[model samples]
Target chain A: MNLAQLQQAFRRWLVNASDESAQLLGSNHVGLAVYQNNYRAQLVGCLEQAFPNLRRWLGEQAFLAASITHIDNHPPHAWTLDAYPEGFHATLKDVFPQNPDVHELAWIESALNEAFVAADAQPLALEALAELDWDTAVLQLTPSLRCHDLTTNAEAIWSALWQETCAPEAVMLEQAGGLLVWRRQFTSRLRQVDALELQAVQQVQADGSFAGLCEFLVQRLGEDAGVMQAGEYLAAWLGSELIVGVRDV
Target chain B: MSTSNPHFSGYGLGLRKEHYCDFLETSVPVDFVEVISENFMVAGGQPRHILRQVRERYPVALHGVSMSIGTAEGLDTDYLRRLKSLVDEIEPLFVSDHLSWSRSGGFNAHDLLPVPYTDEALDRVCANIHQAQDVLGRTMLFENPSSYLAFEGACMTEWEFITAMARRTGCELLLDVNNVFVSASNHGFDALAFLDGIPAERVRQVHLAGHSQGRDILIDSHDSPVCTGVWELYARAMQRLGPVATMIERDDEIPPLAELLQELSMARTLGAAL
Candidate 1:
């Protein structure tokens, strides 16, 4: 066989040792176990790294079984293991249909990792924001910022696990809300945001104009109340270094 | 075994993340430090920050595992571009990858898979190496892989492939001695014969790592200190290719910096004795 044909056969055998391509792997069938083991073990280890808290919640045996299933279904298409675990959240949902919080926990953890290395940009100075015309100024968020709307109490469990405290029991919260994850300096930070704040942040992110943000707030509340709410959110975002820039729209 | 590349000569260690602060805080006695290229290929993060600081203190060697040099689809220009960007920043003393392929079709397996030693495989790998050299504007070093199985195809041996690749592409070789020992034990080939087959002049660096003893094969786990047998083989390698840069690799279960330094000191002592 040629190089391409041999590689194709090897890849096929990796997924399934009983494949017809096994003929090309030579008569030493036992040796094929090494390649198969490495492939599965490396991928499973990647999933574990991507979702440590989830692993603790699900227990090692269950986590490993689910991760193996995920590997069999979605062998990484990316060059680095860093990009391989994005599909694990979907896999967790599939395996734990009754426990939806597992999916949310895995996603929040993955988002934290993504936020840590997404990109680097200077946060807009709070003093500089006062000089801009609020109506025309377009506010930009830090490149490392990520927001997610979650329905489960996964945020509480994730926080406790991250802090090495006694993790609270996973449960569905009465009210659904959103979480904002962003990098401050070198560390990644996340917190739960109220429903109204989530909507306002989403609007500012989409349109990026303070005037539009004010309008979004006004639609949610009255004119005076909306303007005050916008000011409070802006203060929080600035303090968190989530807002990166402001310029004329 | 008459000629040897005189560029780099000293003991070194693989720069793992656990030892980044150790590297930045104090001056380790090693001459150079080798880093896995993929680990630092990020936009902005602590890995990049630590690497920049380490680069200022030590000569860095960019050893990559995802080059997939033996892939039939061809080299990934995007991956190469990122590698070149890093190379431009660090100005690594040497850049290298394995002789094995890591990707097939669109999916990347990430682990280094062994390549069959045949004229067809040789032609493809040589071409890939040539392309890599052209893109990076520097000579590339290809390391020998640890193998678990030999193919059914009747062809040349691994060292013959390495020799031919170096001659054709003008690329240097990273003679991984532990891999040679592991493959020789598993495939029933003479490890010394494998070493003698390669042209010593093309050897630019040597890798020394530990392996796990399995029931039927030795796995290149790189989680322990160098074994007596591998170290003996490394001594033989040093006798053949004098003054080659060497490093101790520990990918898993990495011990304290002092422990690795002790092993590296052995390399220095043994190389000096030779």
Candidate 2:
């Protein structure tokens, strides 16, 4: 085989371990076995490292099974190993169809990983906000911020697992909320927020106007409470370093 | 493409996360530290923050594993761009990758897959090197990788391919001594001949690491202390490629920083004798 053809065959051998591809490469079974083992082992190690809390949550055997299934279905295409775990939630969804907790836990772990490495931005100083036009001002969130809808207490489970405490049993939340992950300075932070706060944050992310967020909350929670809640969330987000910039639209 | 890289003779260690506090908080008695370029290639956060702090203390080298120069298709521009942004910031002592292919056909294996030592493969690697050098605006050091398999090909030896690649592309060489020993043991080739064949002046850096004995092959596992056999080979290498920048690379089962520094001192003692 030529160069491209040879590489394609190697890819096949690594991804599938097919005998045909191996034969085409020549009689090197011992060597090919080494490569095959290295390929799968490296990927397994990547998943294991990326989702340590997920591994603990699912137990060892179940997590390994899920990882194997994911590896079998999805051959990696990204240039960096960090991108490999981004698709693992899909596999978790398929493997644990009844367990939304597992899916959300995976989402939480993956989002935290992404937020840890997302682009750096300076938090907007509270002094800068003093001169802003609330009506036409646009608020820019930190690039590292990631938000996801939540239906289960995966956040609590993840937190307990992280702290090495006895995790509470997974259960469906009476009122679903949201999970937010972002970096403050050098530390990645995760927070579980109420549904209203989640919606307000998402609306602000989409629209980025103080008035727009106020209007969004006003429709959800009457005018007086809505505006008050908006100011509260703004103070909380600013304290958490989530708001990176404020610009006049 | 720039071929000549200024030579610096010093002993250093691969800066892994395990010893980040040791390197950042206290003054490690090493001339330089090498970091995995891909690890710091991210957009932001603690990895970059820690690297910046470390960079302030010691001269750093950017050692990458994802630059699959042996790919038959071509180079990855996005990877190069991210790497260039980092290079501009760190101004690393040396930027290097392996003479192996981890990516092809848009599927990355994330392991250093072997490259057939054929004339066609040589040409392709040279072209890729040229592209990478042109993009980074600096010559890169390509190291010899440990291999478990050797293809049945109609071409020259590994060193011959490397010699031709350096000559044609104006790139430097990162002579991985442990890789040479591992590949030689696995493929049943004369390690000395492989060493004697490469251009000594072109070599700018050296890597000494530990390996494991597999069922039928020696794996470049880099987990244990540097073995006697590899150390002997490194001594021989230093005798030939005098005063080259050398470092100990421990990736898995990392021990305390003091143990690695002790191993690095072995390299220093050997280099001082040379």
Among all candidates shown, the one with the greatest TM-score: 2
Instruction: Return the TM-scores of chain A for each candidate in numbered order.
Output: 0.96, 0.99
lDDT of 1 at B202: 87
Across B29-53, the per-residue lDDT of candidate 2 in tens digits comes to 9999999999999999999999999
Candidate 1 chain B worst ten-residue window by lDDT: B1-10
Candidate 1: Cα lDDT at A191: 87
Q: Candidate 2 chain B, which ten residues in sequence have the lowest lDDT sum?
A: B1-10
**Using alpha carbons, what is the TM-score of model 1?**
0.97
Tens-digit per-residue lDDT, A192-213, candidate 2: 9999988888988897999999
Q: Give a tens-digit lDDT track for model 1, residues B1-274.
A: 1122247887899999889888999989999999999988888866788899999999999999999999998998889998989998998988999999988898788989988888888999988988888888888889999999888674898988899999988899999999999999998999999999999988889999999987688899999899999999999999999989999999999999999999998899889997
Error of 2 at B6 (Å): 0.8
How well does candidate 1 reproduce the true complex, by DockQ?
0.72
Each model's fnat?
Answer: 0.70, 0.89
